[model samples]
Target chain A: MKRWIPVVLVYIALIAWLLFSVFPFSTTLLIALKPKNAFMKFPPDYFSMKLTFENFKIVLSDKNWIKYYTDTIIIATLSAALSVLVGSLAAYSFARYEFRSKEFLMVFILALQMIPAASVIIPIYSMFATMNLLDTFLILILVDSVSSIPLIIWLMRGYFSTIPKELEEAAFIDGCSGMKAFWAVTFPLAAPGIAASAIYAFVRAFNDYIMARTLAGDRVVTYTVGLTMFTNQYEGVDLTLVSAAAFTALIPILIMFAIFHKHFIIGLTGGALKD
Target chain B: MKKRKWIPILLIVPALALLIFVMMFPLGWAFVTGLKSMTLLDLMTGGGRFTGLKNYFKIFRDRLFYNSLRNSLIFVSISVIGQVFFGFLIALALKNKFVRFKSFFRGIFLLPWIASSVIVGYSWIYILDANLGFLPTLASVSPFLQMLGLNRKDWLTNPSIVIYVMSVINIWKGMPFSMLMQSAGLQSIPDTLYEAARVDGAGAWQRLTKITIPLMTPFILINLIMTTMITFNVYDVILVMTSGGPNHASEVLSLYVYNTGFTMGELGYASALSIILLLVNLLVTILYFMILRYRERRLA
Candidate 1:
């Protein structure tokens, strides 16, 4: 009985935390489900059963909404692929080589991760503006990929370190060049890290608000920026529609997270403190 | 290890070049811009006069600067403490022997962290808005909630407590990272130590104090500094939720920098403000490292 008491208490606490975690999302969902004018009622009838798919249908059918999705997906995919390709090369070098300033370079890269997006927003905006690169896909891809590289390098480096160097050495002895040996021997072993880093970069780019908002405009509107457009259009009156749009934007990310959460956790934790 | 002396450099060149072009160069440019008296018009006309140290001096005297500094301090401290505390609690609870379906619970906890800030912000606004909010609506019919002071409508507007409210929401979003970190830390601690403690007649509380906290200190410290640095720069959620409204109640330093540059078109001053933000980040980082090293030396 004594043991059961504490166990039950713990379960209650867990359930409470679960409720707290889920409330905002579930409520947002409820708001999204309500009929167009239903939410405008005095005090807003949150428990109303007058739910409809009209909001989701409307948001999904919009042409601009579709464009935002495509833009976000394109930018995110390109940045992910670019960061992983670049970061893995750096990571491999850090993993396999003993070079001068190696420690300094490693620390420098890690410190780069600490640079906040807000700090460089102005300068980056100006630099790209000067190049006539503002609102271009290339600029967003490059900037987003650059932001993710330092962490990806750290993550992929950790993975590369775990693989045996002897495999590459043996490949070298078997008449393979250094680059070929790497691709043939060490690269496949580091696939998990690459996937993690790619997904990390993808999610970072996809979820990016400030960078995309400041740098990109009508030509390169991301879903996040697009959602802001919905809010602006409705002026907070048709929140049901806005909620619907917001929920729609969340779906892809939530789905991705549900599928790759383990990788996400590993990448987040690994990139932070592990040497 | 003998291949070619330049092989590693060759491999690293792409990433290095990207970093230099995208990050380091902009950082240096930001410094230069901060040294000038530039506006958006000046940026177009290419006519910013050199005003070395003038913007920095202006920042020191600006009332908004001091207000934002105070707000950032409160926001970061509350967020860091709340996140670490709740994260530690949840991680500890989940680590208990009776916990089941651990991965499922963890996945749910991570949902908030993964969602875009725009989604988070709008969802929260609807949930907390004074007139149309779910809580205030719920509070209307429930006397119990009224007794608990949950009836207040200005959760996001009131100048005095808006920063605190934002801090709480931030803690909600960020605790998962800390939980993951603390979970990794907990796993690093072997189970045999607990067995040994039990054999020595140590109760749960004693074991926690002696074994868990002391062992978890380094992880906690790292979590603290990381969350601090992150929270200091996390203006996105605030930007989406309030935009530092109702007389600049929740204008954090980073948000202030952004507003100065973008909204007010004071590019040079904003760059200067950002430099100050960077300095604050560096200061916190150095302070934490000193504490970490001091702990390590004592242990040695």
Candidate 2:
């Protein structure tokens, strides 16, 4: 009975806490769905207010909205794929083979994760402009890929380290060349890890604002870049319209996270927490 | 089967090339640019006058830079503490098997972590707006808020408490992540240790303080490093929320850099300030690793 009391108390507290945590997300949805009139009313009735998708309709109807989503999608997909392709092989190399300056190289790469894009925006902009690479899909993709590689490398390295050495030994004993053995056996086994890395890369690239703001232009703007233009108006911020745009921009990543929820946990934890 | 000498180097080159082009080269260029007077036009023209360390001297003397640095340290410290405290509680609560729908709860908690900062900024702004804000709505309904005079309070606009408000929002945004990390750490603790403590007449509080805290130190270190860095570098929230206004009350280092570079058009000065930001981050990373290595040595 005493133990049951503690458990019940904990549960109640947790329920309240969880509600508090998710209230903002709920606010986003509610505000996003409300028409402009509801927003204008003094002391806006957040709940039981009439809901409408007029905001979404307006946002979706914009010509740049389609460009925004497609550009973001293209950059995100390439960044994830390129990071996985480049990062995993590096991970395998770090896990399996050791060479000169390996320690130095690993440290250098990890330190790169701490360098914010804003810190180097001046130079990157100059260089990109020099090559006519600014506002291009390739520039955005390359930036995203470069930024994502360090974390993905660490994650894939952790995953590679966990796979038992004996599996690779078995393949080697079966007369498989090193590359063949990796491609045929180890690669298949690392699919979950690859998925996790890809998801992380996708999320990281998708959420980037600094890179997009600096490097992107009128034609190459990502959704997040476009979302900020809502508040940049001369008169005042249109909260309802901005909320809708923000929520609309959030939908794809939310769906991605929902579909790969378990992998997100595994990937994130595996990267940082795995022994 | 063959451990080729060149294989590892080959694997590293392609990633290295892209990384150098996008990250390393630009950082190096930033250092050079910081030594000169640069403008938007000078971006491609290489026309900035070479004025060695003049930008660094000016930025160091700027009052806005000082306020931003001070604000960043204060905000980051509060954020790390608040998030970790709440996160530990949430992780402990969720780890209990008696909690039903654990996975559902986990997914819900991930919302703040995975959502774009731009959206989060907007969502918070919608809720915290002084006129039609959720708080004021509660205030209009509940006498408790009126007692404290929180009715229609300008949370983002009030410069004095604005830092605290920003800290709270960032703490909420970062809590789910530390919760996730702490949950992983809590699960990895073997049940036998707790059972042994129980056999020794340890209370729940005693067991947590004596056993759990000691073992959870490593994950807590990781949490500290991550939350500190992210909180320090937070830009978009302040960018959207208050634009670091009514004055420069809420401006952190990252936002200050953007304002100085773009809004004020002082790229060289911004570069110098960011170099300091990088130095601070490097110090923190070094500090975390040193503590970890010390712990390892002690254990051995």
Candidate 3:
């Protein structure tokens, strides 16, 4: 009985923290599942068993919502691919060779990573507006991809460093040119790191609200921006729709996280903490 | 190590060029824009005249600038401390031999961190809205909640405590990153140290303080700095929740910059505010690095 005290206490603490973490999600899920007008009722019926999929169905069938999602997918996917490709080249440069200003350049990139998006947002907005690039997928893609490059470079540099240089040398001996040796040998070996970096960039672009909002408009609405559109002035009328829309945006990312949690953590910490 | 000097440079040119176009050029333009007397309309017409140091001087006198600065300080400090503290506690708790299903607990804990700030903001709104909030709804029935004073309706609207509330939600959303960081730090500490401490009859608290905390200082400092920088820039949740309203009580520096630029059309002043923000970020970063260096020197 005495020994069980500590175990019980630990369980209680864990359960309490767990509840704190999960309560909001459960409540939101509940509200999202409620019938459209049910949430407006006094003393909401959260415990009621009258669940419905009407909200999800409505949101899914809406062409605007569908467009927002597809836009997000395209931008996120392309941004991820572009950042990884470009960032890996830089990462490979850092990993494979010692050059002049290498240390300075690496530190410079790290410092660049710390520049707040909000700080430069005004200039970015003006730059795009001046170039007539605002409201275009190309601008969002370029901006979002650039935002993730520094961290991805650092993360991928770490990955590239771990792969043996001997592998590339062996490929060199087998008549592979420098770039071919990289493509044939080191690239395959660094696939996991590339995947991790790509996903990191994808999530960053997908979750970017401020950048997407500032640079994008009607034709290029990401889900984050679209989620805000559901927030009409008449709060309750769109509350269910907003909730449903928000949840719909959440599912794919949640699924992605669940599938690649290890990569997600590595990416989230910017490779600062590796398991 | 390079036969051709240009090979590495060639490899790096694409990334460097993109960064220059996307990041560096914008930053340079921000400085130029900061010096001008411009608005959103001026931006379109390219008509702002240079007014050197005027916008900078104005920020020093702007009451709202000072207000947002104060709010940002409060928001960043509280969020950082709460996140690191709660994260460390949870990491330690999960490290215990008695804790089971560790990964399951960790995954659930990370949900808030993974979800978009917009979603997180709306979810919390649903939970805290004055009329239809989950807490108020639950409070109507539960005597325990009412006793605990969790029945308040102005959780998002009350100016006085709104910043603090935002800090709490920020903690919920951010603690997992610190947890993962601290967990990695914890793992790096050899188990033999704990075993030796136990052999010496040192209790749990002493073992933690003497062994764990001492070795974990560097990790904690890094965690602190990272969280500080991240939280300083975090206005997304705030944007979605209150839009820095209920009389601008919750507007941090980043959000204030956004509001000033886009909402009020004060593009020039906002550009100046952004430079100030960039300085604040740099100041905090340099301060932490100095502390880090000083600590390393002492340890050495």
Candidate 4:
């Protein structure tokens, strides 16, 4: 009972923290599930309000929303694939080579991770505009891939460095060429890292509002951008529709995070702070 | 071995070139474009003339730019403090051996982090609204709160507290990442160190301050730097939540640049502003690399 005291205290604290953490999510979810006409009341009046799934139904029913959803899925998938492909190629070179200017290159790539998308959005838009690529899905994809690559490559390098050189050495001895040895032996070993980075890239791209809205605009509205349409035409925000649409935009990534929190957390910390 | 020197170069060149084309080229172009007078209409036709430091001078003279830079600094400082403090507490609590279902708690705590900034801003708009909102509703019911003036938080509208409110929101959103980082740091501290401290008759507070904290400095530094950078560049939440309204009370540098470039059609001026921000980011990154180098040397 004496030892149990501290454990019980820990549980109490944990529960209190969790309630605070869960408040926004639960309230938002409650609002989303509420009937369209039901106004938010003090005490929340859950029993009195007519609860319904109509908001979610409305969100899904619109073809515009479907296009937004499809656009996000396409962009996220392709960008994740691109980040992994580009990241792995560079990461492998960094891991395997003892080349000149390696340290300089490493630092340069790592520094690229901190370039906030806002800073580059102007030039990126201008460059793409010059090529008549603005508002296209391709531009969003390119921007997303570039933004995701720096971190992915760094994480991939960390993963590659962990696998012993002897595996590739053994492959080489078995008559495999350098590229073949890497593909046959080393690449498969880095699959978890690849998956983690891909998920990270996907989440970043999917959740993006600034880049998606700025570059793609009305031509390729992502879910994040589409959901913004719920705003008041004049005041520029509508809580009722926003609650529904925000909930819709949130589910896929939330589910993904719930399932892969371990990989996500590890990959994030490993790539960032670990030397 | 000498012949294979170019092999690595070949392998990396495509990726490096792609990155430069997509990432660095835009930055360089933005810098060059900053020297020119460009707008949305002239974007494709190349109609803007070279104006040297005219755009830069204009941004420097702008009051909004100064306010934004100041706001960014304040927001970053406030957020860095709040996130680090709350995050360290959460991490310490979670690190307790008595704490059960650690991962479950971690997942719950990460709700703010997992949600997109837009979703976060959207949710907060309702939560902090003067009417039909949580805080105001709570204030209405609580007599003590009403007596103490503890309720009715004007989270988005009030210029005085808007930036602080934004800081708190980011602190909540950013705390989870720092918590995880702190946990990693805690785990890396060998148990033997704690056992030795215990043998020497150290109390819980002493152990925390003397052993746990000192050992966790690197992680703490990382968290501080990362959260600072992230908070400084906050645009989406502010854009969606307040649009930097209430007389531009909460406009950060990113929002200023974004509005200027995208909305105001002052691309050249926006580029100059962003370039300033970019230089800040680069300077900080260099400092971080130096710190990392020093830490590595000490550890080795």
What's each prediction's TM-score? 0.97, 0.93, 0.97, 0.93
Interface RMSD, candidates in the order listed: 1.5, 2.0, 1.3, 2.4
1 or 4: which has the higher DockQ? Answer: 1
Model 3 lDDT tens row, B182-256: 999998999999999999999777998999999998999989998998888899999989999889999989999
User: What residue runs in model 4 are displaced by over 4 Å at the alpha carbon?
Assistant: A1-9, A40-49, A232-238, A271-275, B144-150, B286-300
Please write out the lDDT profile of model 2 over residues B1-300, one tens digit for every residue: 255799998998888888888988888877887888887767667588889989888976889989998888888999999999889888888878677898788788778878877778878886787886777677888899888887756888888889888999888888888988898789799999999999999998898899999899888888888788777777777787887886998998888888887778777777777787778777887887888899899899
| Clashes (candidate 2) | 0
2 versus 3: better DockQ goes to: 3
lDDT of 1 at B57: 96
Candidate 2 retains true contacts at a fraction of: 0.62
Q: Per-residue lDDT for A19-118 in model 2, tens only?
A: 8777877787877788787756676767675888898998888777678888888899998899889989888888878799999989888778778765
Give each model's whole-structure lDDT: 0.89, 0.81, 0.89, 0.81
Q: Model 2 off-target regions past 4 Å?
A: A45-48, A164-178, A231-238, A273-275, B1-3, B297-300
lDDT per residue, candidate 1, A1-275, as tens digits?
46677677777877777888888999899998998787667867787688899999999999998999999999999999999999999999999899988898888887777778789889999888888899999999999999899988988998999999888889999999977988898888888788789889999999999999999967999999999998898885788888888888888888888887767876777654232
* Per-candidate DockQ vs. reference: 0.71, 0.62, 0.75, 0.58
Off by over 4 Å in 1: A271-275, B1-3
Residues B198-238, candidate 1, lDDT per residue (tens digit)?
A: 99999888999999999998999888988898889999999
User: Which residue runs does candidate 3 get wrong by more than 4 Å?
Assistant: B1-3
RMSD of each: 1.7, 2.4, 1.5, 2.8
List model 4 lDDT by residue over B36-83, tens digit each. Answer: 888888876788889999988987799999999888888889889888
Which 10 consecutive residues of model 2 chain A have the lowest summed lDDT? A229-238
